[model samples]
Each structure stands twice: as structure tokens, then as C-alpha cells.
Target: MALTQQQRVELSSLVGDRRVDAVVAGRARMVLWRDEGRSAEEVAALAGVSRPTVNTWVRRYHDHGVPGLADRPRPGKPAEVPGSVRARILALTRMAPPAVTGLTHWSSRELANYLARHEETRVSHNFIADLWRQHGLAPHRSGTFKLSRDPAFADKVVDIVGLYLNPPDGAVVLCVDEKTQVQALDRTQPLLPIDFDRTEKRTHDYVRHGTTNLFAALNTATGTVTARCFPKRRGAEFLTFMKTIAAAYPGRELHVVVDNLSTHTTDEVKTWLADNPRIVFHFTPTGSSWLNMVEIWFGIITRQAIRRGTFTSVTRLTRAINDYVTAWNTDAKPFVWTATPSEILTKVRWVHTEVRKLLTNNDK
Candidate 1:
């Protein structure tokens, strides 16, 4: 009962954990059947099943090796381009706007087409999708994005953000940003219920009540949030946000991190800054709004509180947002980051690399 050279390789394929693989290996054993290799009754008793099960395993062993037993992640033809091309595809994907490739936007199919024609890399849209999943560049729906004018923006923001990572005792770390154009959209008719099979849908022409600006300062220590809702976002509006923080905690030097929007740096804002000696403004390098923690939090509100929600008017939207904020503040705690300064720096370095090696439309 000596095994063949092919059987070893077959065993290797079934070495990994899988149901059928284990069964194949179990049946490949020499002891499974009697000396005459009578598997009929032995298979029925041991497997508590049919005679064909053991016979199939014996027949398969005579045919292919372990690779035949193991399930191949891909079943079709190999690509013209190897993993290097797949890596290239990912590098292209991480670039801010995938549209520069004349794709309007990237779907896996578009990427596959680009690869097949340009790189001479043959792949299916399905394979491109697999690549997308691997790279964490899903871009399902307008991923949170911002473009900075400063070439040194990521480094600068990383430096400012580092202050929070290793903050001094009793120091105030504030994430300040403006949420502009928060609107109130009222439906023509109140949202009506639908059948169990479908979701509620609304017709166009919903009423727009009005909009408001939210200037918020998140206290990194106490996990408290202080915000001001204004008709417009201006230096004046930002001052109100700062003043709210000032009143809430007197005698604390505040470390406020804000975006580089013009309204946040108006002449009036600069004037207010001169008077506020205790306030330190840590501006996220221009165009790096994602560095603002509030923006991250705002996304949560947009998804959970705003998206698909029907508001009767701007006032209604405003009230709902404020109400959600009030309720949120009552219990919401600031997110704690465990990533060390080195880890954050490492990530920013990669972002810088992404910008440097950005794949152009031609690179496809």
C-alpha cells in the first residue's frame, strides 16, 4: 500500500481546512479499507452512509493530486498580467479621483476594461472586484474626500495631529470644523408606509425649509461637544463656537484644530484671534478635512441621521439635527484612538506616497 508521487501533492492540497478536503484525505488512508481494498461495507459502516462515497475518494486519488482536492480561489484562465499588474491596478485606484482615467468613475468592469486594453492585462470585472476588496478602496458611494492646495499638507496635519496623540496633562484638544449647507428638506407628503417587500419611496419636489451652519468643538479629554448653529458660516460664527467653549470651561487654554476654509480665517476671524490670547488654532493642512475628527463624526450623522430622512422644511432639518445633537451629547463619548504617533505618521507617509506615485490616465 505504497503511495504514489502524485498522492503527496494531493495530500498537500487537502492539508488546509475544508469539509470535502478532509473527507478526501480521510478516505485516502490505506487503513480505510480491508487488505483486499474492499471499501463497500467498510465505507458504509464507518461513514454511516453509501458505498459510492469511499469508491469516489479512491477513484479521485488515482486521478489528481492534492491540488485537485483543494478548492481553487479562481477556477478560470490565468491573467496575462501577474500580481504586479494587480498591484498597479490598486495603486491607480488609491489616487483621489479615479475619474482622471476617463472612466467618469471606477466600477470593477471599467477597471478591467482599462487593464485589458491599456496594460494588455486580461482580467474579468469580477477579478477586478476581488482586487478592490483586497485593497480597501471600495469607493462605494462618494467616499469622504478632500483636496489640499499645500504640497506639505499631510505632513503639517500629521504634525498638528501628533500633539493630540501625546498631549500634555490638562491640555485641551479640540477638533473644530464647519458643517455648511445643512438643509431642511420637507417631503410633499409625509413619508408613507410601503408593502413588506419594498422600502418607502418619495417623489421629488420636497419642500426646502432652510439651512444652518454647525460650528462644533469636540473636547478631546472630557468627550464633550460644544457647538453653535448659525444662519451662515463666517468668522463671526466661528467666534461664537469658540466663545461657547470658553464659557463652558473657563481658565483652560484650548487647542482648537480647524479646517482651512476661508470663513474660518476671515479678517474678522483673525481679529477675534488677536483678542483670544488663550486659544491656539491648529489648522489641518489645507484640503485635509478628513483629518478633522468632527468630519468623521459628521459622516456618522449623515448616514444615521440624515440620509434618506424626510424633513418638511429647513427649520425641521435644523431642529432634527440639533435634537439629535443634544441627545447625542448627553451620551456620546469622543472616540479614543489607540494608534500611536508613530503609527499615524506611518499612515501619512503612505498617503504622501500615494500622492507622489499617483497613476495618471496614461498609467492604466
Candidate 2:
């Protein structure tokens, strides 16, 4: 092939530039080699392509220049289901199934059957499944949510998030909560140990020895937990736990984050707080106990230590809890809070707007 100087420069740039497509670059290199008087077979060997491919690109370049070296559009098989059918499937997937159908959510087969009978749109269940996957729809799954109705929700959010992200100097921030009614459960039968292709098995029934409440204080700076188990969750127990936390970090101002539990705000607790002026309380918004970092630690302990433990007595369960706490604090790492108050407030407002729209539509 013979090329103009400008064409040669363009082809040379495409061959050398890394950003160009490999196939286009290879074709450019082949044409350049042909222009340099290299034989087709030699160019094919250098480009790792067949002689036929080299000759075909040379012919393409001769006929339509650089544009002809690129791939042609491939007309693949047309869609089996029409766009309107796909749209209807997605729209129905977002809604609860008809009450007459006695379905809480739409299964692929059920949805396909319904459409075939009612809408005269006959499609296989597999096609419905594929359509749902394509649009990221899952009617079978649902999640729970709650919006705080506290009048001071925004103020409380700002106060708590501020403590988490930017604690005051010379002060200790503790997320305090009580995990109540932790049962000591013993399996009815000995657990069958897990082996290859076999999971650990235990009886579904358990003997409940007793229950205890755990009061935990999580240090936001160091992630260490100061915890104790009590027979009851009451004002007296909460006050004692507070005293323990205060004693643990003497001579420092303490900011305790707690939920709006009645025990936490009892008259006795209030009187004690009045006496200990250095310790202050920050109440999370009602129904928003997840704000307390200790709750996250509580979940970890439950899953790791208590859930599968075969505790024959409350003392054994309490000992198990203490051991887990000791192990956790040995390698403690803080759960860093990243969400700002404004981001949280935005999401809350969006939830409120969505709920209002849903209620309004339901009334209509």
C-alpha cells in the first residue's frame, strides 16, 4: 500500500499511542509495515496475525482509509420479548401482588402466570427472572426502617454526631447501653461437631437457665469496654454502672451517650448525676439507639460468644461474656463514625417525604 505523508503520520501516531484500541493499532502497524515495503507474511508474523488479515486491512485502508480499519457493526439476534413487555414486568415487580392472588410478593413463575392469564403477555418464568435481574428488581426481599419522632431529633443528632467526630479536649466520650435479658441457654443434646461437608448440629430446643443484663461503656477514643453484669435493669443498676464508668476515668470530664430508657432518666439517677457534676448525659433520639457505639460491640459479643455457647448456668454465661470482653479489649480498635449530621438529616427528610407520599396514595 502507498500512503500520503499525512496518512502515514496518522497511522504512525495510532500505532505508537497506547490509548488507541489494540486491534486498530495492530491494523495501523500492518499498513505502516506494508508502506515500508515489508511483505504481507512478514508483517503478519510481526503483528501476530494471519497473512490474510494483513492483506484484508491493507485493502481496507486503500478503500476507506483509517476508518475502514475499525470493526463493523454486528447485527445480533433481535429481542424475544418486546420493550413494552419488559417495562410492564418491571412496573409490576415494584408492586405487591394482588390480594386475590394471596401473595405478599411476586415470584417469577407466579408473575409470569398472572401476566399470561390477565395481560395476555405470555413469557416463560426464566424470561421474567432475567428481566428482573436486568433491571435490578427483587420483589421477594424487603428491609425495615423507622423514622424518629422526637421533636428535638435534629438537635440531638447534631449533638451526638459532634461528640463522635470531634470530642472535647480533656473529656472522655463513652457510649453507654444495657443489653437486657441475655439468656443462658443450654442445648438439649450434645452438639455434633462439624466435619467435611457437614455443619455443626444442635437441638432446636434449649434449656434456659436464667437471664442477666449487661451494662457496657465503650470509650470512643480507645474502643475499650468497661462492662458488668447485673441481675436486673433498673435505676439502681444503671446508677452503679455509671459510678463504675466514672471511677474508671477519674479526674476527666465524662460525656455519656445513652438511649431514652426510663431507667437511665430515673429520679435516683438524676439525683446521682446532680452530685457528680463532671459526668454529663446525652440522650439519643427515641427509637435511635443504634447511635450508641456500644450496641455494635454488644452485637459482636452476642454473635461470637453467646449465640452458640452452651451455658448451663447464668454464672457460666456471665463468665463467657467477661472472657470475651477481656479478649476484645486486648486488641481494641475504635469504630470510626463518618456520617455527618447533615447527611443523616437529608436521609431522614427523604424518608419522611416518601412516607407522606405513600400515605397520601393509600388514602386515594
Candidate 3:
């Protein structure tokens, strides 16, 4: 729906400013009241503004017309780092480490020094940082972020999310991932097991008995979790896990969403997939295991079932974990995620440039 007359005037004057100016905002109501079918008092009450404020907007509109209600031009010193300086900074950053310039890695201080001496523009490290920030460049932390380059990334993303949002009419949607090296530990102090009144558990500190890999699948529609303990989580083990999923849902085409682990996409596995069309594999974007619902299930297992529990052997650890998973399945329910694809993509875009900074120093 289009905005109301009152809303338009208020928005124009408040666009650059963070908050609405009460007086200027009230004038919007006055302007609305003068429209073909509204009385001044009625418009004031409807717009939740005082009559004087309403009258002001109407009077200003009459005097200056459309641009009258717009915000005044904001005043500030023009940027010292003009277009030429910004272009030079970007160009320098994209070049090799400053060995040619008789220096080492481009530190903030060094870059600022070079700019003032060589480019004839003296600027502080903070100013250089701010300029780089405005362009979303931060080489110091550039490698920490990642993005996908799949040609069919968008379609694949929609398909993956759709499995959770609206699965096939009859089949179940399972989000799956592996949790590796889950250390079985006893805390430094034992936790007393709590009853219905409390959730704390008794524990005694014990040396960690190595680690176990957990393969988990969460039914998104039901919130039920099915887990398995494996010797080691390699491609062969992953193939076995896939077989388990197939057997679990006999005669049904199981839609499985997994991460981009190298083993998960090996040639043998791809051959198996080709041979069995019923099992569909949807991969999440690279470096986004957080998007997998099975990760959340792992957290629950850690908090409610595993932490502080004393286990001396793999058998006992396996039994305790199985008990927890069984109980969880009986009471499982789907998690609510309302984050829109647009919202996620917007956040990704904001970090895209900073992520690209790592590409600058090395052409290869």
C-alpha cells in the first residue's frame, strides 16, 4: 500500500535525520487536513499531531510547494580525501607488498606516511581507516569471511530453504551435519544431579577418553533428531551415514541438506548418488554450517546430556548419547526461523567488500 498524505510529508523531512522533528512532523497532519476530504481537527486527531503543527505543514506547502517540507541540506567540511586520493589508495592497496616502494607490509601508519609524502596529501591513520571503512576495506581481517560462488547458488539456496519451509507433500525434510571430536569430559568439580526442581547434574572430573564423531539428522518438520556414533567421520563413514538415512526412510525419497565437506562430494559418493535417485543432496553455502539445523541439535545434546558427565569408555559414552537422542526424538519439534532470504543476502552484501580485501594484496 502507498503511504498516507501525512506519512509522506513526515518521511521527506525525516529522511536524513534519525528521528522525526515533532513540529515539522505535526505539519504533515496539517497538510493532510487540507486535502480534498478532511477537516483540520479530524486530520490532527487522525495524524496524532497538534493542530498548530498540522497548520504549519499546510502553510509551508502553500508557500514553497512540494520541496517545502523536505529536509534542509546538512553542512560539513568537504572530505579531505577527495576522489583522486581515494582512487590512489585503492590502487596502492591492490598492488604487491610495498617492497618496490622500499617498505614491507602496508601498515596503516606506513600507508598514511606514503600518502602524505608521495601523493602530497597528509592524512591520519584514522582518516585512512575511515576512508577504507567507507569502501568496506579491512585487509587485517579480510580472510575471516567467505561467500559462495556456485553458478546456481540462488536457485540452490531457495530449494534448500524450501525443503524446510514447505517440504514435499508426504516426505520428511532433514537437515544433517557431522559433529566431530566431541570430548567426553568430567568437570574439575562434580555437579549434583538435580530433580524436577533443577537441571544441574552430579559429575566428577576425569581424564578425557579421546573423542567420538556424531552424525546427526534433524527432521525440520517434526524437530525429532536421529543420531549415530561413528569411529571416525570420513567420506566412507559419511557414505555409511547416507545408507542409514536411506534405510530409516524406506521407499521414500529422503531430502538431505549437508555441508560441503570434501568427502561428502567424492566421486564414489557421486556414483552412489547417481545409482540411487531417491536420495537428494542439497549443500549449504560454503562456511555456513550455522545455517544447518543439526548444529542446534548438537548444542542441545551438549547442554542437557553430555556436559560434566563422567565417561571412562566409548561404550558408556555411546549409551548415554543414544539415551539422550531417543528422549529428544520423542519430544522434538521444529525450530522457528523467520529470517528472510533478503535479510540474509543484505547482511552478506555488507561484508562482501571487506571479504574481497584479501584478494587485493595477492593477484594470484
Candidate 4:
């Protein structure tokens, strides 16, 4: 039967409408398939029904329009699962399993079993899983988070973020940090290179040559990095790097953003800062190394070079680090900081509130 444009539109709408009963929707889809020149057998197979069933729906759709697709009233018992019960099931899934259950979280099987055991609801694990999918709930997975407990988090955030967003004119703003104890480890055997249907493979064991510390100063304005490798991460090494960065941007005042390490705040470092008068230090809040943009550079280098690299000695490792830094500076872009101090503090406050609620619940 040829469908008018209006009939085709209505049939298409019924086939796509999720609010319609699935049986009705399936029948609508069958009619659409027939309209598209599919034989009854093909339509039946696609609809997972008999050829007669497909023919019946197509004929009914032709006779009675969309109403023909709905299931006719039949003499049978209604569904046993109550709406309230399903709501309760969803509510339970959102909550932690009771202490007696000895579960950190709920699996579909566990949740179904718990419901059956406690409230005597005869639900299958598959049914529970379907319910979860329909409602978009997942109780099985979790992520890790930490609250910054720094007292001066606000002040430090504004200071560092300020330099990143609006740097001082004529002064150099550098994010300085040490990637400490970078190890040179060679695989026990040569790595098997990847090919069709295979991954690159390396031996589990490795030979540790030694470790070196990379002190890097990331130029916030231009994204170029000035780096030096050191055998030690002492105040002396840090001061030397500071001087190197200072000399690199000669005669300009330097605004260095560093994490609050003991070495960074040592009396010796303090005296050097006083001597250099033009070099100013802005310490990131305790435990918040993410504020320093150098950490982002460290992540890039580690992922691109250090993590999977094979090195025989600290010298080779240093050479690799220098090579990567040199390449990075050639095309480096400054890591832009977009979060305002108020925005950051607002998010931290929300996290703090969440942590407090968790602690309170635990206490109860």
C-alpha cells in the first residue's frame, strides 16, 4: 500500500517515540519497513516476530492509521511490580549498602538479592540493571577527590592566577618547580615494536642507572622553559637555577611562582632573594602544586618522553630532558589559567561541604 506524506510522517513519529508502548513502536517500525519495499519475511525477521504478525500490523496500520499499532485489550493479569516499589529500588541504589550486607557498593545482582531478601520484591538482576539504565544510575563506580586545607589558599590562588591571566609589564613571570628523582631505567630486553594486531611490549624488569632532578622555570608570557638538571635538589641547586633564570631575562624583575618547599623558603634562599632584589617569589599554597603552570609542562614531558623512555644512565636521561625542553620551547604555548579566585574558592567550598556531609554521615 502506498503511504501519503502525512501517513509516512505519523508512522515515522510513532516508530521513534520512546513514550509509546514498545509493542506498538515495534509494529510501527514493521509498517515503516514494509513501506521501504522490505518483504514480510524480512520485516518479520528484523522485528523478531512471525511473517503473519508483520502482515497483520501492516494491514492494521493501513486500515486504522496509528491506533491500529497499539496492543488490543486482552484478558490477562496486569504487571505485579508497583511504581512505588520501583522508586524505592532506585532510592536504595543511590544509598550505601547497609552494614549487615558488608558491601561498599551495590552490583545489580546484589541489589536485586537484597531487595528480595529484605522487602520480598521478586526482581531479577537483569530487570534491576535495566531499571538502572532507564533511570541513568550507576552505584558501582567512584572517583577520588581531595579538599585543599591550605589556610592561605585564596591569597595564593589570586596571586598565581593573576600573573597567568594578566602578567606584569617589563617583568618576567615564571612558574618554577623541580621534577625530583627522575630515574633512568632501561628495560631488561629490547621492546617488541607494535605491528598489525599487536601492541608494543616491554619486559617487566628494568635496570636502574640513577636519578636526576630537573629544575625548570616556565616563562608564563611566552611558554618557553629554561631548565637545568642537577644531581641534588638542595637549596644550592635551586638558587643556581634561580640565578640561571634571572640571567636569561637580564635586567628585568622576575616574578617566580614556586611551591612551598623547605628549600624554597630556606634562610640561604631568602638571603639570595634579598641580594637579587629584583627577583620576587610567590609561593603556591601548601599541597596545591597544580597552581604552578610548570607542573603542566612536567606532565606534558613525562607523558611524551619520560614515562615510556629507555635510558641507560643519568647523563642519557639529562640529554633526553634537554632535547625535549628545547623542542618544547620552539613551539610552546603558555598554559592559560581561566578560573578566577572566587570561582576556585566557590568550587573548593562545595567540595568542603561535601566532605563535611560525608564526615557527618560517618559519625552518625
What lDDT score belongs to each candidate, Candidate 1 first?
0.62, 0.80, 0.66, 0.78
Residue-level lDDT of model 3, residues 218-241, one tens digit each, is 888888887899879888988898
Instruction: Quote the lDDT for 271 in model 1.
Output: 80
Candidate 1 positional error at 321, Å: 1.1
- Please give the ranking of all candidate structures by lDDT, highest first, separated by commas: 2, 4, 3, 1
> What is candidate 1's lDDT per residue for 19-99, written digit by digit as tens?
232344455442234334565676555544467665655555556644443334677776574656676777656544444
Off by over 4 Å in 3: 1-153, 191-206, 353-364
User: Considering only N, C-alpha and C atoms within 3 Å, which residue pairs clash in candidate 1?
Assistant: 9-66, 10-65, 10-66, 185-311, 186-311, 186-312, 209-313, 209-314, 210-314
Q: Model 3 clash tally?
A: 8
What clash pairs does model 3 have? 30-54, 190-203, 191-201, 191-202, 191-203, 192-201, 192-202, 193-202
lDDT of 4 by residue, 166-226 (tens): 8888888999999999999897643211111122223355788999999999988889999
lDDT against true structure, model 1: 0.62
Better of 1 and 4 by lDDT: 4
Native-to-model Cα distance after best TM-score fit, residue 304 in candidate 4, in Å: 0.7
Residue pairs in steric clash, candidate 4? none
